[model samples]
Target chain A: MATIADVARLAGVSKSTVSRALSRPEMLLPETVATVQDAAEKLGYVANSAARFLAGGRTGVIALVVPTLDNSFFAPIIGGAQARADAEGRQVTVAVHSFAAGESLTTFGRLARQVDGFIIVAPGGSDDIVRAAATKPAVLVDREIEGMSSAVADTASAFTLVVEHFARTGRRRLVYVGGPGNSWQDAQRTAAVRAAAERVGVSLEVVGPFPPTFAAGAEAARQVRELRPDAVIPYATALGLGIQHVYLVAGETPPVVSSERAIVEALGLAGVPAIDVDGRVLGDVAARLLSQRIQDPSGDPNRVRLSVPVTWGA
Target chain B: MATIADVARLAGVSKSTVSRALSRPEMLLPETVATVQDAAEKLGYVANSAARFLAGGRTGVIALVVPTLDNSFFAPIIGGAQARADAEGRQVTVAVHSFAAGESLTTFGRLARQVDGFIIVAPGGSDDIVRAAATKPAVLVDREIEGMSSAVADTASAFTLVVEHFARTGRRRLVYVGGPGNSWQDAQRTAAVRAAAERVGVSLEVVGPFPPTFAAGAEAARQVRELRPDAVIPYATALGLGIQHVYLVAGETPPVVSSERAIVEALGLAGVPAIDVDGRVLGDVAARLLSQRIQDPSGDPNRVRLSVPVTWGA
Candidate 1:
């Protein structure tokens, strides 16, 4: 087999010099590195990745964990994570907890030390795995896990943004379409919405804490009809897409992905007059937060909370 | 700060035994391994990822390269990759080529040594990257680069499945929607549809070779309306989603996401009586192919082509 030795002989350099040029080219003189490369290319020699890696501790890996993705709110979150990792020149392995506590614990137990760090989207595990993250450079987003640094939109402020959007538009019967009851996020948003209602003097009908899914979003539309709210506000884009599908099929305003529980998505389309909080922003923010914790595990980490104000489409 | 020595002493084993228990763990006795783990857990001692990686070799990272996820077609393929990686206890990093050939080559260069291996989806790069992948343990799925071991589906067969469905539905006038003018997959599917049209004696129209996008699909709707075919088949799921959207909002039965545009994904979601094919199966096939080649690089390599029939879904 033509190996680095062959390239070293051909390029008139010592074997150790060839190894340095091949593995740590930056440590070599430019002409020596170039000559070795030219000889290697001629001989069709490629480095043995495993051997090179064993000599250096660069695994080049990061992991992102999401509890479940059957619900699409995590879609943008996933998208955002991918983009941020791309920017950092790192690759991410994503793990879904399946919303089952036992499965996540087992998944992370095997996974904790494999990657450089983890970006956990709503960890679902027994107390064992949950505690494991505290020892690592872990960061939480959207869902809160104790003893971890988190970057979450302050839902209290977010609900205020949604409610004020309704009032400014002169819509009095503002309805809050809640997410699944089991989610802590649902409770947080619902409470924020109710508090906003008191401040704004609007009849805020808290329609749910329903399943945070498109199918459930369609069902919420049925409730919307019965309540007859002047405006409907669903928490995330995935739920919004479903409710929009119901409204569009029923010949309602702002035609896009939702009518038949999400018909607009069927077309190569973007939402019209959509409220995009930009999950990429959320992801970039989380990456910075997580990287900081990884760099200094002992520091009292800062939590960043943000909410983009909403506005109606023209 | 508690090191492997502490765990080894607690577990009544050598430090080397403790190291072996965590890295290449298959080498250790189960009971001894358990003792070391219990002691480590009790001490709240996390393995320093850097120190342990010296013996473990690579970072356990897998890189997945895709065209772009702006299309629904790419989303499921990514989902398939994620599922397979999770099952095998690996993390995946994704990179997208934004239709810029030179830029993609640069991305591959930056990514080459960083990842353990690559799984490229419809590669868009210079011949150098393709040459690199050929010698390295990289797998190709969906599209083939000349030298790499690839997993591919019979576009002809996938098209046959879609055409047969249209025929059975009594849709006489059929049209094929293609991706942007230069897309290889679109041309392949378009040709297949043409062949099917001649065989079935059905009137077929070729409406596009437009950029495969939702907006592009919506724009194609104007062309389809002029031709007025009873059945529309785009190259893959990307355009199908678009056609379905335009039809739903505009009140027409434009097409499905798999209307030949991205059929593998189209059948999975929205199920609009399209052909369903699994990308995960293709990924596994690709992995096995690459592994065999990596085992012996000089062994005369032959192009492997496999086709799995797709089921028409409602």
Candidate 2:
């Protein structure tokens, strides 16, 4: 609860001197900075980020915007991002855009003035809107806009792994279940799976752009069964679990390849294979990159792509 | 983007009049309130809740505190609550308490100042801490504490239905797999099941205070099989799915009772019966109750309990 004025009075320095030492220490004298820091430490001055934002520009708070909090897809990412931010004395406020067009832009417009930066996860808005909204330091996770820093999973390699497994298992035809059409990850995944299937000389049938739920997956499963694909590739774990359930109910053994280990685990998919994308690691990396960008907003955007490996359960 | 000054000028009123019209309309003259409201709507004065908090006591934002966001148990609840809050033009900020001792109290301390009210879901804190934290307008969801408004699921009736199903099916011994020890719902469900089992003249074996994940369920399944319970009752869908998987892997046929429809649907527990607790409905009701509390902080606390019904899937 100690304020900057309290630290300044304790250090025998002006309020501006203490502010300069904290924000631009390199420009201040070392002795002055050291004295200010010592005084701040003695007073246990945890600078109120919101109050600082009123005088200075940055509030040590960052925002992580996701489509929705209902799925486990964003849970680890959110946990990782918040943990990393908290370690650095920053707080993360999560806002759900709910895959609505222009929702991200609207949320960003409201939050940008308060938070120092943003880490938008799989934004549903158009690239133009995203670019316009991110006036502050911003990092996009699992998607890439033209002018934003991003951390994306290696979808190409993930699909290649799944397709190779299908080929090895003599599954010539595969049905690909997808998520929302506006989803950047879903589009990338579908394109990658299509390219991979062509490379492996297997027929790939793309089913949907569903809401990424078990019910939607079950509904898609009926379509998949009618089409009779030799194997299945679901873009998300939720969809995969749904398809798996429909198959289980019909007492049919259908081969499936999922994109997340969490779904495989949740469905008790032993002997079933999935690509481990590690959303937490992606979230951590994105937070680190965003923090760096917030410190220096002039550089070219940094793009990080984490690799996804196939994991099999016993 | 229209400020209070703009609305006041347009309405031919003072800034304080505009503020009073929005915060406490009852204090203003009816004609003056209508004039201010019309001017505010014309200028599109969507008050920034954070800035409003600094000027006025209430911030149009509410907090939804959950133990963790990872499990599907709270997903629908969160979604429904947010949806309802959004319809009322209130923003809900979610904070994870992680179910650790003192975690809920710490979160309440941090969030209590900025939010107008709180909707705490399945609070893991002790009764004293929970009661102390309700100094502000608050609603406890899925848990009950003395001197606090609450919306709890009828776990006693839910367990009675499950036990009756077991007794009718000729399953004498039922193993109950539980969630975290700190979980309020877990304790209630376990105690209810124990009482119901005695009434039904059936033997009940208690297994866990696990993390309520598939791995925990699988690990508990080993212990469950060793005990050779006639049927399994997992407190959560994730644990139920895990137990179902272990049974499938061992090719063992055991009747299982689950507590969530979403889980049953996700895991395709068609033949397996489950109690449909409808978390979305619970969330909506809790949000409504909390909103009411925020409006009238001095009212006698409202307590609601929704019933859970057992459904046999085909």
Candidate 3:
């Protein structure tokens, strides 16, 4: 309940001096900063973030923008980002904006003025929208735009492992169940699957641009059943689980490969091969990149790609 | 990108007038408000939230504090809160704080200065810890404290349905796998199950102060197997899924009842009866209550308990 005036009065300094001592100590003498800090600690003074923003032009807050939380993929990313931000002494303000063209433009514009920078996880956003939204320092997650900092899980390379596994097992025909149309990760995954299948001389069929939900995966499974490919690869684990359910119900044991390991294990889907992409690591790396970008906005954008591991299930 | 000065210049009014018109229009004359709004619309001026906070005490932001994101139950709650906040023209800032006694005190004190109010989902927090963290207007989810606003899912009542179904099916013994030790919902569910079992003349054994995770559930299942109960009731769906996995792997069929329907279905658990509690609705109601409390901080606290439906799956 102590105010800045109380700290200033106790420390025998002006309120602005107290603010500078707490936020930007290098601008003040060490003795003055120590005196102010001693008074503030005795009074249990917690600086108001909004007032601090006005005084120092830094809110000490980071904005993490994600499209949706409906999918299981995003929760760990958020957790990772929050943990990293907490370690860096910054608060994360999560905004769930549907990045659908013009909608995110306003969200980005409004949030850009409040926080120090952004860590955006908008795989579905177009290049123009993503670029326009970067009015503040930003680090994109799972999406790469020219001259933008990004932290991507290299699932495209991992998809090659899945393809090689299928070929090694003598699976000649394969079906790849795609995810959302606008998703950059989905596009990259599709291309990787296509290129890998061609290299192995395996006949491949790419199916519908599903919405990456369990129900959509089930629908994709029906189409996949008609194709009757030797193996199936899904862009998302939720889609793979849905497809697995349909096959199990039909009394068929079709090989299904997915892009997440935790979900498959959590669901007790035994022997389901997965390309493990640690979303938490991805989020942590993105937050670190965003923090670096915030410190040096004019520095060269760093592009980090985390290697994905393949767990071929028994 | 238009500043307040630009809007004021176009509206033929002072900058203070423009700020008041955009934020607190009721303070100014109708004609003056209309002129400022029209000019602001033409210029595409977006109000800076930090500036608005300095001008008016309200930040137009709500903070949703959750214990952790490791569990699936919290995700829907967050999604629902974000959706409702968006509709009300407010942004949601999600903070994941471990409410382990003294840790959350600082988080609450710091966030209290930044956000207008809070929607806290801290089921694992002690009553004293929760009360101490509520420095701002707060709405508790799934926990009830005296003189505090709360929105709780009535899963306790739904547990009676599970007991009754087990009794009808001629099950003589039941084992209840519990969640976190400090969780009010888990305690309430335990009491309900105990009362129902006593009334139905069925023997029951209680096990675990588990973490409400898949691994913890598997451990609970091992304990329950030793007890050789005829039926099992788990406080969380994740726990139930873990128990189910153990039993399935052991080639034994055990009737497991969970507190979530979506997760059971998503995991392809057939014939698993579940008590369906809509976490999204609970979160929406909590956010709404917090918004109302922010408007009238001195108003009487509102305690809302949402009904939970039973899905007797086949």
In terms of DockQ, which candidate is strongest? 3
Q: Which ten residues in a row have the lowest lDDT in candidate 1 chain A?
A: A255-264
Candidates, ranked, DockQ: 3, 2, 1
Best by lDDT: 3
Q: Write the residue-wise lDDT of candidate 1 on B176-236 in tens digits.
A: 8876655545666778888888787788888776776545666777788788777777765
Model 2 interface DockQ: 0.23
lDDT digits (tens) for residues A106-141 of candidate 3 = 435546656789999888867988888888899999
Candidate 1 TM-score to native: 0.72
Report the number of the highest-TM-score candidate.
3
User: How close is every model to the real structure, measured as TM-score?
Assistant: 0.72, 0.76, 0.79
Model 2, C-alpha of B122: deviation from truth (Å): 5.9
Please, what are the lDDT tens digits per residue for candidate 2 over residues A235-261? 776577567656665666656555466
Measured against the true two-chain complex, the DockQ scores of the candidates, in the order shown, are 0.21, 0.23, 0.33
Which prediction has more favorable lDDT, 2 or 3? 3
- Candidate 1 vs 2: which has more lDDT: 2
> Residues B150-207, candidate 3, lDDT per residue (tens digit)?
9999989999888878888888889999889978898999999999999999999999
